[model samples]
Target chain A: MAFFAAVNNWLKHFAYELQGEFLLALKTIAAVFRRPFYLPEILEQMHIIGVGSLYLVILTGIFAGQGFALAFSVELADFGAKNYLGRIMAIAIIRELGPVLTGLMVAARVAAGITAEIGSMKSSNQLDAMVAFGIDPIKKLAVPRLIALIIMLPVLTIICDFISLAGSWVIAKYIAHVTTTVYLSAVRDRLIFGNLFIGLLKPVVFSFIIAFISCYKGFTSGGGTKGVGRATTESVVISSITILVVNFFITKIVFSQLKGWL
Target chain B: MIELRHIHFSYTDKPILKDVSFVVEDNESLVIMGPSGSGKSTILRLILGLEQPQQGELIIDGDNICTMKEKNKRKLRKKIGMVFQAGALFDSLSVGENVGYYLLEHTNMTLKNVSEKVVQMLGFVGLDAEEIIDTLPDELSGGMRRRVAIGRALLSTNPMIMLYDEPTTGLDPKATENVLNLIMKLHQEKTIASIMVTHEIIDALRVANRFIVIWAGEIAFDGTLEQLRSSDDPRVKEFLRPFLSSFTEVVQKRFVEGIATENNSASL
Candidate 1:
């Protein structure tokens, strides 16, 4: 009886949190269309998320691409199919690995920053101060962040995809003994519109998941420093996991719909 | 004027304020005193429209805030300025930006003019505007932050009321005195009713013309300073005991001196 009661309470709490998150997302979307848009705040966020994450994304793409290419080269050597390394690398990196890995990395870094900054403000009563001053925190804080993420995440993923392809090229030429012309031709042939579409789409969804979840956690955080710390950790963990989980669903849905195109 | 009628508030299943009622008139300085968690600060929150009571009518200058639309409520909030605990200055903004935030957002004031106004307000609050304008809240001393917050609250042109929630909490004695002095200065300089919530009775008595003590979510006592001193309520006595015991001589002497001064003025 006690176990059932606990489970029931947990379910109720989860549902309540879900409802809050959904409402926040709706409000943020509505706020985007509302007048008095905070252009400076949006530009600042774009700079922070886009220019700030450029180096990290580039590094991740390089290493991930190189690692995958090295493994593929060795495996294809055994199968006497080393010539197809570029095609396989292009398919895996662009459609499957690029968007998901970039989302996870960006989530881990950006979500924590967003949560900590907002959570600290909350603990310090600045949020209440904003409310006291009659400024809508969602419009002032959440909307700018959501807008920045929406614009920057796909851009970052594209850069990550390009860098990863370059990294794979280097490995394929040096290690797989594949000719550069053949590898480039193979990659160009396989990099279809469908692959690019799925890759870009995943980041857009991931951006929403990261921004809304992190902001919600920050806004709801309490108990001072410890609470802010807990919220930050939770934001990163939840955002990363959500990105991974949602990536699967998006892929499943898109693939089912666009099977002929793929 | 601000009125809270039969205000009942609860954050959860347990109630924080039960049937709390009070009225604060224009330019009236009110000191709300209570033990911690007795809903003293909650009253200020209720008035600021930061939190709505589960059941009550909060009328600010005739309109029932309980039923006011959120947009109208926001407009109503312009007449009320709040100095949250520890100043609650925006951490990311510099002191000047924090003080001029309202003007920048609400008014069509030019940046140059807003900067001048912020400087003037900061000076009025006894802060050296040039020295601190560029400084962030985290760099300032506790007292300085509170002063910046007070300046921010008072920056608007037509503020009718000011709410200070534990404004002097977590400050040194000198800092507390500085903040209390600033509050008294603002009260004298502006036609604004001030509601201050504090645990310090001496500080409360120094600034407030009237006192309301909340004990366990109810008003235990509400009257002038004289009535508060002469009250026989056990709860009020218990709450005031520690502070009054130590400062009885000082309080009595101050009252006697005040009466002597009044008598002297009457003779003149």
Candidate 2:
């Protein structure tokens, strides 16, 4: 009975948090519509969240694609199926590598930075100052980040997808001595627009998860400097882990439905 | 303008304010005097609606502030301004921005209008409006930050009440005199109720029309400055004796605590 009671309490708390989170999201959306457009702040957030993150994302993208292609080519050669390398590379890049890796990189670069900056503000009572001034810190600070992530995540994922595939293409054509014509044909036959579209959905969900969790952690950090550090670390770890888990479940659902739809 | 009745607050299981009660009339300046850990600051927080009393009523400006919703509480808080012990100025914003933050948010004033009002308020606080308006909080001296904080509080444009928590904590003798004078001038000119919490007896005697001394979470003495000075009460005598004998010591201690670390590091 005690165990059951604890479980019930946990479930109730989860439901309450979900309701509160939904209300917060709705309020934030409403505030964005009500306030004057802070275009410079949005552009600044985009530069920080998107442009500054490019080098890390590209480096990870290139290596992931090359590494995956090299492993798959070796395995295919052992099975006397080296011609399937392009198909494998295309499918893996579009279906999984591009979105998941981009999400993780963004979790490290953007989410952690947002959490640390806002957490420091909270600790130093700057957020309290905003509240005392009747400006919702959520509206001023969180909204720009939320909007930036929503717009930039997809763009980053697209760039990651393009670069990763290019890396695979280079390995297959130049290093592995695979003919360009054969590689292009195999990719054309196997890869579809739906696969890439499915991958595109992950970044949007991951972006929301990252921005929401990081902002929530930072906004609610009550203790001082130590608390800010803990929140920053937690934000990155939680966001990255949740993105991967959500990506897996999304991939399963999308591919299962796609199998029938196709 | 503010009344507390039977306020009971505790941290964990240890009580800080137990059945504390007081009243400050409109335009009246009330000084709360007590030694450290006497729940003096807790009373300020209670009045400012920062902390809710566990069992009591907090009435501010004829409103039941204790039970008000957060939105209503925020509205009520606008009628109140607080100067924290450490000034609590936003380090990220300029002095002018910090002072005019409230007008920018709660009013439809343009940047130009806000800047003008900010300059006027800075002048009222005796700060050079043009020189330090763009400076950050870290750029200002301790006394200047306190003045800017007072300016920020004044920007609300005649708050119904001002709650100051240890306003004279870290200042030299001259700076303390300036702050005490500003408090007196503000009370006389603005006609707003002010509640000041300080252990400094000189500060209490300088501006306070009435005094409330809290001892162990309860009001030990509540009356005029003359009554407090002439009272036979042992607690009042003991509290005032230190102030009377060694005003210089009090000033020196504050200066040492405030400036010593910075000077030591600078020399190194």
Each candidate: RMSD? 1.4, 7.8
Maximum-TM-score candidate: 1
Error of 2 at A86 (Å): 3.6
Please write out the lDDT profile of model 1 over residues B76-177, one tens digit for every residue. Answer: 988998999889999899999999998998888999999999999998999899999999999999999999999998885357999999988889999999
Q: What is the iRMSD of the candidate numbered 2?
A: 2.3
The stretch of ten residues in a row with the least summed lDDT in candidate 2 chain A is: A125-134
Error of 2 at A140 (Å): 2.9
* lDDT (10s digit) by residue, model 2, range B14-40: 899988888888888899999999999
Residue pairs in steric clash, candidate 1? Answer: none
lDDT of 1 by residue, A1-262 (tens): 9999999999998899899999999998998898778999999999999998999999999999999999999999999999899999988988888998889888988999899999999988899888878789999999999999999999999999999999999999988889999899999888788888898888999999999999999999999899999999999998998888898998899999989777
Per-candidate local distance difference test? 0.91, 0.82
**DockQ-based CAPRI category assigned to the predicted complex of candidate 2:** acceptable
